[model samples]
Target: MQIKQRHIEVFDAIMAAGSISRAATQLNLSQPAVSIALANLEKFIGFKLFQRDRGFFAPTREALLLQDEMAQGLLVLERITQRVTEIRAGSTGRVRIATNGAMAINFLPSLIAAYQHKHSDVNIDILVRSSRQIADWVSTKQIDIGLIDTPVPVAGLDAKFFNLECVCVMHRDDPISAQKSIAPPDLAGRSVVAITGQHMVDRQLDTLLSAADVTVEKHISSYYFAIARNIIASGGGVAIIDPTNGKADLNDGVVWRPFSPKIYHELALIRGSNQELGKAPAGLYNLIDRSLQSLIGIGNAGDSNE
Candidate 1:
């Protein structure tokens, strides 16, 4: 007959408790049941596991040889069961995410840290790429989630859009920083730092400046809003950047003010179409949604034409 799990369990319990009656109590089985299981295990293995003297049970040489391995195997089994339970409860898993550089550098680290604080067992992998690359990864199911600049360059992916007003950031000591809002005319003749390569923010700012009959000297151009903020902090020039990056850190000698005519930096949270996110990814996804809503609400409350 094949060795059964009951045989191994009974053997382990007797070895640990050192008596048939005690092992029976530990396993909640009758003494006769424990004796029968141990007998069956010995017969199957062709060796004596225990030597009995009066009420005492002593481990045989063969039993001693198997004891350490059996204990280790049992520990491994227990750990596997625990990990399975954690998986079922949504407390442990790996989540893969991809996003554009702006959020990757300026925003997501703190959010990820807060998430890990509660679900420490959940492993997370974050990748920074361009918006188009992030969209492609989400569409192909290569990532659990993607945060990207809109419009989403790929189709067939589920996307949630957030429209955030861009803000003007300048050195804290700059006179414009004292204003609650900055209009295009306020930027006229001022040295401006802007995103490179005719980005959406640059186009929007250009249109507004033209409409206001004002022109600002473009002093510098950068690929990322966070980099532009660094330039602004160093007293390079004022910049209109995404509110997320603008308000990321205020103690860096930079202050953000709501910009008039309300240029918006659009972003989209994306995932594969028809794909269901696992528990850990879904938790993070919901957290990001709530946080972004809170940020947008704060920005709207502060926006004014005055």
Candidate 2:
């Protein structure tokens, strides 16, 4: 027997309304259309659905048995439709992000705020660690995205590189601040706060100083940029770091200026090579790029070219 949704709908409507005329009105159908639908439904199921007397209809035992299943089926369809609508509206999701301490301290928070304002239903998890750790996290699928500066390629991760400018940070009243723009030669004989570890930024800066044959007093060395910045803030020595980290230095009694022979660190977004960014993360990637560009004071608000 052949059957369709119209057959069930007309059958249910007739059972509920009790008369062909009332069922037609309820279904926005003519009386003859309702009667024909009832006849077809009875034919498809090979059973009589109603007992009629004086143009009134009543459900048979078979229809009473079918009503519960029909009701459940319609309920399931309603839920599926609602859920699809919710997905289209971007109403629910979760994303995890891991990044180096530098990006976390000076950047991501503000960007996350703006992102949350727009996608209020999305849950975000932010973790701050060493760049190497963040890369591993991305590769293992422990996190959805990462931002870091690395000179070497990480296996199982895709990178989008940006030429992020580095600068020399020092105490505001220090004599190097008077140089307008510092150089490898200008740093000679100065007490310097050097960033330690195998970080690419530190390595690049070290190579540049070596090429210029510049040597410093090497006052204090640390892995975290904030520690180095703190030393510089206390009038200890000059520290070469990113401008974003030093942008807040002035308030700390220190300031930063560009280096003469601009050395750049490659800052990139790292993600699992096998994973693709979804709607929320893609929006977040743009926000991150835009925030980085803004912090460096180099690009317009719309220059977020992932």
Q: Which predicted model would earn the best TM-score?
A: 1
lDDT of 1 at 165: 78
Which lDDT value does model 1 have at 161?
A: 87
TM-score of each: 0.90, 0.69
> In model 1, how many backbone clashes occur?
0
lDDT per residue (tens digit) for residues 1-306 in model 1: 986667778879988899999999999999999999888888889989999989778999999999887777777777888999887777789999988887887678889999988888999999999888888888888889999888899998998888887889888889887788889999989999989889899999999999999989996899999999999989998999987788775578888888889998888988899999998899889888888887778766564222
Error of 2 at 188 (Å): 1.7
lDDT of each: 0.87, 0.75
10 residues in a row with least lDDT, candidate 1? 297-306
Model 2 lDDT tens row, 168-265: 78787887676667788988888877777656666676788899898768757877677778888887888877656665523778777777677666
Span of 10 residues, lowest total lDDT, candidate 2: 297-306
